[model samples]
Target: MRQRLAFALGYLRNPRHVGAIAPASRALAQAILAEVLRNDAQVLIEVGAGTGAITRALMPALDRLDRFLVIERDPGFARMLSAHFPELEVLNCCASSVDQLPLDASAPVTLVSSLPLLSMPKAEVQKCVSAMLSLMTHRPGSKLIQYTYAAPHLRPFANIPYGWRWRRVVSIWANLPPATVWSLEQTPRGASIVH
Candidate 1:
């Protein structure tokens, strides 16, 4: 399929970022969006949205008041998403630069990501995760949905910030390499905001 070929090409271009040769399965897409469906959030922001795999699943849930932002660092993938999914407002930028966006703090937001966290350098991974956590603090109760090929038993890195805990864990066997989806929420109290 077109998606499979595009994904393969992207992976070939940058294996560290793309992390997989095939696009996510519809089952994985559906599972990711299901978390958004369960929440009443009106704003959705997706990071590393390669080829709009998850953006397509988010379409039905969008309304006039809703804001869906898809961020991709690759220009080729950004263009593809813009051309194919005209409804999405795709931002061609790195996930680490998300803090620069003029995101509304008061609005409820749901963040879904396909970023290859496990493969990224520890510092880069921490930067992106910290930026997202900063956003969540502004929009209390905001949730972050991320998928990894790693199993649930694989613990988070020791350096990861505290005050964020998993709300749900789903094993998606239908994906190319199989993945586990982690739905996360900030803890009610406080954890020193990491910069």
Candidate 2:
């Protein structure tokens, strides 16, 4: 309940960033990450980690060698995440800077985003999607996971580069406003969107 209050206050402070009235329910978080496997990727990056709702869910699933990187733009939320999850490497910066992170080039990175893509400006969302794609190491199965309250058929980007594909995995109705999990995978250099 305390965490929910903090999340609500954060949302009130900046509706555009926080994006939701309450923290994500455990069920929603679980559904969003249902397909994630700790052994599939070397790095785990969670963007828009508001109050560690999804972070808490990802904690137990993470492999011992996985590098957990968290990106939170809000200073207050970042501080809270740092305090609550001392083991994680929290990066207090905008999600657009995902490509700028000092990551290992050879290691595959799996990104999980809680950002409000439907509410954010299209250009901003494009920038984030492009940056994330640019930064991912396409070692066969590297992918990105994101949940949205929008329609299940809505792809993150209408015209992405030739190598990426996104598909809706599941719709979780237990959340406050409900959401659908979208898994984006990086295929070969010339592959197109995966219907």
- lDDT for each residue of candidate 1 in 1-195, tens digit (9 for 90 to 100): 888888888888888988776888899999987777877887888999998888898788887337888999888999999998887789998888776678775776788989988887778888888888777767776888888888765533334346666644688887988888877776557554331
Per-residue alpha-carbon lDDT of candidate 2 for residues 29-103, written as tens digits (9 for 90 to 100): 887566666336768899999999999988876664368999998999999999999999998998999988887
**Model 1 weakest 10-residue run by lDDT:** 152-161
- What lDDT does candidate 1 reach at residue 120? 73
Q: State the TM-score for model 2.
A: 0.90
Error of 1 at 28 (Å): 0.6
